[model samples]
Target: MKSTMANLWHLVKGVQIRDLGEKRYLFKFFHIIDMERVINGAPWTFNNHLLILHKLKGGEDPL
Candidate 1:
């Protein structure tokens, strides 16, 4: 996950990945705009797993 985040670090100003238990994760991005790009142009696969992204109304907190 760290490597994948590093690869996309430029496009994204900030992010925090929290394991919400199970295999689910919560990705908090600094800008929802950048998050939109990731959602639209995503499923960023590295290795064999797809980097699934989802959008919600709110989930922003500066970590």
Candidate 2:
């Protein structure tokens, strides 16, 4: 999933994907522009499964 998303975004600064349990994931972007681009292009999907995105605050649990 990580590799696939990284390829799809093609972010210059790259991103990190970490499993957050219960089918959730944390997408950590290395650059603000990269993050904004992704958020702006919302409603991303994988294998026909809808992906829900949420911007997390510092020290917040993404569950």
Candidate 3:
């Protein structure tokens, strides 16, 4: 999970880790992906999909 956060920190800005009590930390990261090429409502690309997976794995925030 640490590695995922690290990668996100490197790729995006405004990444934060928040303490939500009960020994829990929340990681938040934002990315802007263009979806003009989508035929239906699928607004995600392969890269974005991978990024979401990485974030969910509990990576450390580099920031």
Candidate 4:
């Protein structure tokens, strides 16, 4: 009864989410503050496990 990643435009203007393959989604935000907010202020939760968000450096891919 709800939409996920449906109102991306409402969240960030001119932002685009691209599929980088391997079940990974890349989001480009225009503002560095937005990225910092996501990395430091965003809240993630799971049913039984803690959600870990990693910052991938340039030319780095998680295998």
Best by TM-score: 2
What residue pairs clash in candidate 1, if any at all? none
- The C-alpha stretches of model 1 lying farther than 4 A from their native spots are 58-63
CA lDDT, candidate 4, residue 38: 57
Q: Give the number of the best model, judged by lDDT.
A: 2
Per-model TM-score, in order, reads 0.68, 0.88, 0.31, 0.48
Question: Model 1, 18-37: lDDT tens per residue?
Answer: 87776777777788677777
Q: In model 2, which runs have C-alpha deviations exceeding 4 angstroms? A: none
* Candidate 3: regions farther than 4 A off: 1-9, 32-63
Residues forming the 10-long window of minimal summed lDDT in candidate 3: 32-41
Per-residue C-alpha lDDT of model 4 across residues 1-63, encoded as one tens digit per residue: 002332422344334556667655666666666566656754644344443556668888644
Q: Quote the lDDT for 3 in model 1.
A: 52
Task: Indicate whether candidate 3 or candidate 4 has the larger lDDT.
Answer: 4
31 in model 4: Cα distance from truth in Å?
A: 0.3
Clashing pairs in 2: none
Task: Please give me the total number of clashing residue pairs in predicted model 2.
Answer: 0
Which 10 successive residues of model 1 have the least lDDT summed? 54-63
**Pairwise TM-score winner, candidates 3 and 4:** 4
Give the higher-TM-score candidate: 1 or 4: 1
